[model samples]
Target: MKDIFAKDSSGEMVSPHEPGYDALIADIFATIKTATEMNTGYRTPEEVHEYMERILGKELDATTTVLPPLYIDYGKPVTIGRGCFIQQCCTFFGRGGITIGNDVFIGPKVNLITINHDPNPENRSATYGRPILIEDKVWIGINSTILPGVRIGYGAIVGAGSVVTKDVPAMTVVAGNPARVVRKITTPGQQ
Candidate 1:
């Protein structure tokens, strides 16, 4: 009997109980939890940066600033571009991969969730995942939740406390649950 949900060559989500899946999750959790816990007592940003680099196995850009208390399921699949500012208490479920572009501003307590379980009750443990793309210069406000497979376009602004379940077009401002476009933001001299 073959496992239907097993990831093919194309890299997709497999059953959570599949061989090696639990081990991988456990490793990620151990590393991230230790780093985050250690980071809480560090008084300097440089210490946090070094700790995050060790946990992620990659050095973040010098200009990037991520406040402490950040949570991530797997740091390997997460990418942060240059000059991005991620405030404290942000959580990322990056097993499905999260790509954040340069100069992005993420307010505190935002959640970027990239994986979801099968809707069927009998196979609820089976999971599906999608990559989230946050384009350059986007501003995601405080307490927002960006759901799986969402692509937030360049220069868009997601209002505070919004639940973004779909793609947001460039330069648009969206708010509320199942976020709808409130208005288009005009760049300077765009009259």
Candidate 2:
């Protein structure tokens, strides 16, 4: 059996040997397949949490809740803050590091990708990654992607289906690929 948490040559983690390796791998593949087959419908938050608890080896913090069918590669380190809510089907490929701050609400189908392979096929085997940081009280809309080396500032709001490629300033609202600031999240009530 393959290790479910093996470290790659670059010191990044890949699947390694574990008793639960087969089960976890099978479950992850099944979830992805099931998500693709779903005809549009909303899943309850509680259901999502239960699913995550089943698929992931570790228990999430009580204040850090994830909506069902979240796909996270558990080989790397990921930290969620208190009162954080992660929506359904979010993919956190945490080969580097992913940090979600307190009171952050991540919308459904969000992707936080921390590592990337080289474009040149010859060098592609070498893996490189950067950390993704989301500050306190940030709300990421549905289907958004936070790319490597990104830092979403405190109180920032990322719009639906946006791709964040750079650092977002504090209290701003950004949208679109390589997200741009459109507004500032000013008041506590506004955010």
Candidate 3:
């Protein structure tokens, strides 16, 4: 089996024709399905945390909280930082990678997608992935979709229902489809 981490000029590439691709996809789907089920079935915070940890393949910070019904593809590529709060029904497509920094708040139903298909119809099944970096103290509003390869900077706020297709500068507030900066925000404790 070829290493899924194999990189190329366009970042991570996974094709249906590639060796181990089918098996890898199957394993990822099964893991995510079981984790999702466990998340809903478990009532206690500890139980939910345990299931989430298994999905992530890492321990979440004690101060971090992820609500149930979270969705992820290839959870191994996702990393959440300390003191973060992830609301329910959020989906992460981390085939590339997803890194969420400390003290972040992600509202419900947000989708962070890091993978896209080739533009050519003949090669549509060929997938390319890019890493998403959400820096410290960011707030992502409900129903926002952060597209592939976006770097959301520190302390930025993504407004509700926005489709973010580009990089967001630090301390800025952005909204709308193909999101644009609406205003700059002043950090708390700043004069």
Per-prediction RMSD in angstroms? 2.7, 5.7, 2.2
Scored by lDDT, model 2 comes in at 0.72
Stretches of candidate 3 off by over 4 Å are: 7-10, 188-191
Better of 1 and 3 by TM-score: 3
Clashing pairs in 1: none
Residue-level lDDT of model 2, residues 4-72, one tens digit each, is: 334331345343242554664575465455443332356565554445444443455676776556566
Residue by residue across 49-104, what tens digits does model 3's lDDT show?
A: 78878888899888998887888877877899999999988988887789999999
**TM-score versus the correct structure, for each prediction:** 0.90, 0.70, 0.92
Ranking by lDDT: 3, 1, 2
Evaluate residue 110 in candidate 2 and report its C-alpha lDDT on the 0 to 100 scale: 94
Model 2 CA lDDT for position 41: 58
lDDT of 2 at 132: 89
- Displacement of residue 85 (Cα, Å) in model 3 is 0.6
Across residues 92-165, which tens digit of lDDT does each residue of candidate 1 receive? 88767789999999999999998888888888877777889999999999999999899999999999999999
